[model samples]
Target: MNTDSTRRWLALGALAVAMLTIGLDVTVLTVALPTLAVDLHANTAALQWFSSAYTLALAAMMLPAGALGDRYGRKKFLLAALLLFGVASLACAFATSAGQLVAARVVLGIAAAAMMPLSMAVLPSLFPEPAARQRALTIWITSTAIGLPLGPIVGGWLLRNFWWGSVFLINVPMVIIGALAVLALVPESRSAQRFRVDVAGVVLSALGMLGLTYGFIRFGEYGWGNGLAWVAVAAGVLLLGAFVLWQRRTAHPLVDLGLFQSTGFRWGTALSIVVNFAMFGMFFTVPQYFQAVLGVDALGSGLRLLPLIGGLIIGSRVVDKALPKLGTRAMLAIGFALLAGALALGALTTVDSGYGYTALWTTVLGAGMGLAMPTAMGLAMGELTAERSGSGSALIQALRQAGGTIGVAVLGTVLATQYRSELGTLNRDPISDGVNAGVSVAHQLGDSAMLHQVQTAFVGGMAAMLWVCAALCAAAAVLAAVLIRAPRAAVGEQQERLDDAPHVGQGADASESTHVS
Candidate 1:
């Protein structure tokens, strides 16, 4: 490879490292939740906040982060985000209470919001060739996936041998390395024209997302009888509706509503939500099942998740080869089919089901997500121009984050409700509240019958949640079948247009160097 080519690929490596740290932060807490409950005296609500806080902040800030990067420079903003993430992780590692940890997670989320979208948006600028960009994107997506499995393994080991806080500390070194590499290698890029940041849109989007996410999370804790939950949901829906109207009317909107005109972008975004909803929802339950029900240690639970990770990695590798032949619609249909099938299989799991049963279904779930997510994301991003890449990428990612947040909230509510209902006359005041609490209570009481009841109820709840996911996946499959389009066949023509397109900040050399494929 030429020197210029080598530098670009190296730049991609830096971006991937940064992406991995954020991704690892997402699921790392799943395995650590039990440990947190024991050490920090975290209740069910606190546990939910640990994950939801980060995702909610991420979803809320993504639009602003992307716009900032577009208005300023992607590299500089990314560097600052990395620094903030490192510091926040340090704070999280040393948190004394559940509230402190949740607060730190919010800071980490804000920092990550800046990093995630900007790193992705910078890709088209770095690897202007379509083929190179595809390869880079695959690596980028794979780096994020690598963290999902690694989070369990690493967090498991840390929780087993060290303190629960080690999980957050692990991110520090990764952040430092990512920052240095990015500073040395990645090129700066941004829109030449300064677009006014829509402060009203940002406020509306953030409040709407926070309201909806907090409402569902609260519903899981307090049930639907709580009027506050419904009020928040209703207010969120109204605010989001207002946000859409405002964006449509604004002269310089935070998001380019016109991007939805592309059929690929529309369905791709919808499918992305479906994939994350199922994926995140499943991740929420698996650790609890392994630790609380099966009596496994953290490390053992992490190892049990290996098959799912393996399937994800293998599926990501296979999609590129399959996409050309299968076309977008066919690949998406097959992917969602696997997803629905996997979730249906998961729903059949019993309290006494072995690890092999869980592994089989989770592996299938992973494969389905691995295939669907990247393909849909590629389609959504494929037609976006370089100038609008930051806002565009942020929109895609923001919705995906929102989907994950809502997934956790909705599925958690389902699980909690079903578990309580299945308990049937059992005293569940504080001891038998959630799966973890019920398990702890049964162990303390030394009642094998009570233990059995708790496990059975928890399993029933899990099964109910999986069934809901399966139904959603089935719907996503139908949508993908009807809406997703094939890859655009005219690569050469697209490249020619890109070359001729006016670039304000960059020179002719920058445009000339960029190849469409």
Candidate 2:
């Protein structure tokens, strides 16, 4: 209960709030998209940009941002990011046109890019002890998970009671509180070497991620056969390759290329990428089933998803506790197995499938999602040092968001293909077609018979897509098994290291007690 300890705890809380705000913004805007389109007189492309623009900026800027924080000071950058994020939120709230909203979101994305990785980087400095760090990380991650469940509900409620801009406005108060707290409580931490920002690496990596994401999105809309898609993909690949080479050569690279030497960082990042691919795909697809197939409203759609939210929290907590006993490999393996099994079981769902029946498997899938994300993220942070932390932390988050962008792009492509294939075999028009094609097809039909057919066909597609998710998760499990370090050793090493140091400037009594004990 000394000054430093109190400040550290308060700073952690503030970062947790920042985490909630960012994650909440991700989904809050989703529920309000239709209203936004109506008010702005926007077309489909503009609506796509409303969402994609933020994600694109987030993905592109994260790595470069980390290097910038390292070169400058993390605390300075974090505070600036928070203040600017609030300003951008207000700008977003009053956006009169689709273009105006997109511009504000880009600004928000740049600010968000700073907040996220820096939050991770800041934690170790706050709680240097291994146990303390783990607990802090758990709280930090849990805050993020809480946002996913609460976001749509809050957004829907706000939309029901207020204007769509209310969703963005809600961010105003949180940002103010977070910025003030950070200024008061957080201690500044930095690298030993005075690192310079990797300007070339930044440019190449940014272009690479942006191109890759855009290519996937466009590919979803216009098949891979499109010459533009091929060209875009090639450019993305070439740019990424160049970026990697640049990192290897640069003295103070945007990211530390050597971290890939850690099997944990490599596989954990890979798993995060795939999990997001599946997670966002599921998040979008389920609502369609509830609203279009089950004929539920927005509230009902979100409510039905609660089982998923609940199960995820439970499963993740279990993994957090079990990791000490079961190790990284075992937890990731079991987690992936649960997801694949649930996805395979999901293939059996029909339009007639009751929530009672489908709930358990989807719940299992939720558990799998919950187990995987924080563990992987925590491990990624664990593997980094203060020197590489900013860029390394940024890489972890960048990959996940990139995973989301890629998922939307890839899953969107998969769905379109399956939908077309199913539609061609039917006698219905686009507007009249019921959900049909894959596990996803059990929705969207106002017509009963058409609904049944769509359900049947779409279930087929959903099954196939889930099969892909299954394979990816299963593969990630194998990768984690081979690549991630065992937890027993990691914990022991962290404890031994922590034992030698003062607990992040905790009270002198705590350090004396650790020595005496």
Candidate 3:
């Protein structure tokens, strides 16, 4: 037993637990959204912000945080992130007003942005061998995945038995545990390079992400023709373009623009964007479908989602075994194909589709996600050096997050568009009466049947949306094929010793010993 590698394992276990708390927070709060909405008397926009704001902040800050982690020390940044995350969570528990809660959530988001990337960033420093590194990442990925489906299951139980704030409170202990363990076990590592922090890059990226997210969100409610939505979209495009241009001219760019020049990294990044587009799209609608349509309470909805969760767990394990054999390109293709079919099957979804049917399709979609997501991530992470991992991982996660948000914006738009179309055909003015027909249907017809129409329209939208997901995944497959260079035995034999790693319902690795089949 090598003394150094063993310590990395112990340190990582602790860090995984700490990071898992943030991962769980993403999905855990999702199930509690309805409860928060009712108890706080918040409207739909507030509810959307309740979830979206955290993602927005996380996406915005991740690259900067990653860079900061490298320049400073990953371990040091990780500990600080845990502390801030814990403190913010406590504030969230006590929030009285919607404004206060949303603000706290944004703060929490910033803290989370720090945690998500740095945790994985420190991993390579721990186990220098591929075998152990892949194993460590598996555990790390598994811990985060464990928190997801359990969020609603656990949050619902807590909400049913206690209060909605109970969810945030649970994070308190996890943070304490994470901070203490990191102090005891994790050693600090960062880039030896003296890279300047790209403030302009940071600002432009933030503005662009927020603008696009806001534009999509506003469009969901106001329609494609809305002036404000178009403004948001245009502003987002221009700002993001400016950010890219600035990066090229800068001496120390926030992200190495050259990384994308690598076809492997570029394709891997695209793979990440597409997978999240599908998974996070599910995150937005799954809860509503189960609660509003399936006529289930939060817990029931979470439980019904077991199929997808179960599939993910199994797929994660399966992919780990397969990666050495299938290679990243093949695994991604297989994964995306399964998921695309699941989305198509979702087109047949009905109000009374039954959990069996729902479970079947979700499982298929999830299995594909479990397979494709990690393989691509491994490729992306592998492309970076240890010093760059913090920034690189953050870039991957941040862009992936942005993709998830865009997924919700786009898919939610589809659902809303379909819903409004259906309503227009009905010639109904229920909404004009200051009544939510969707809400009223929930009470009178049982949320199940009413939810079916919503689900049907949603699935119909998603069916088409799923094709986009498939094409993206397929495109990623081709990109991986044409662009991704296999490690030359001479150059990469040692490095391959580590290339290999998955989930966060709210959010959120590579290997050589085994080919990613």
Name the candidate that leads on TM-score: 1
**lDDT for position 191 in model 2:** 58
Q: Candidate 1: worst 10 consecutive residues by lDDT? A: 508-517
Candidate 2: list runs displaced more than 4 Å: 1-6, 427-447, 482-485, 495-517
C-alpha lDDT values of all predictions: 0.81, 0.75, 0.72
- Alpha-carbon TM-score of each model against the true structure: 0.90, 0.89, 0.86
Give the runs in model 3 whose Cα sits over 4 Å from its true position: 1-3, 38-45, 422-424, 427-436, 442-464, 467-471, 474-517
- Clashing residue pairs in candidate 1, if any? 130-516
| lDDT, candidate 1, 1-517, per-residue tens | 9998888888888888888887788778887888899899999789988987887788778888998887788888999999999999999999999999999999999999999998998888887766567667777887887788678888878887899889999999989988998888888888765667888988988888778777776776677788998998899889989999999898767777777776766777888888887887788788889998889977787788888888888778788677666666777888889999999999999987888899999899888977887777776777567776788889988888767766777798888888889998775676457888888888999999988888899899999999999999999888888765444442343354356544537533322311122
Ranking by TM-score: 1, 2, 3
Model 3: lDDT of residue 477: 55
Candidate 3 lDDT at 262 equals: 62
lDDT of 3 by residue, 1-517 (tens): 6776666677887887876787688788876787888888899889888877787788778888998997788889989999999999998998898888899999999999999899988877776665455556666766776577678888888888889889999999989988888888887887766567788888998888778777876766666788988998899889989988997898777777777766556777788787777776666666666665566777888888778877887888888787776666567667777766776676566656777887898898778877877776766666666646788888888788767766776776666555556543332555222113555654676655454454455445444555555566566556555655652221253264233321111111221111122
Off by over 4 Å in 1: 30-52, 95-102, 430-432, 487-517
lDDT, candidate 1, at 410: 78
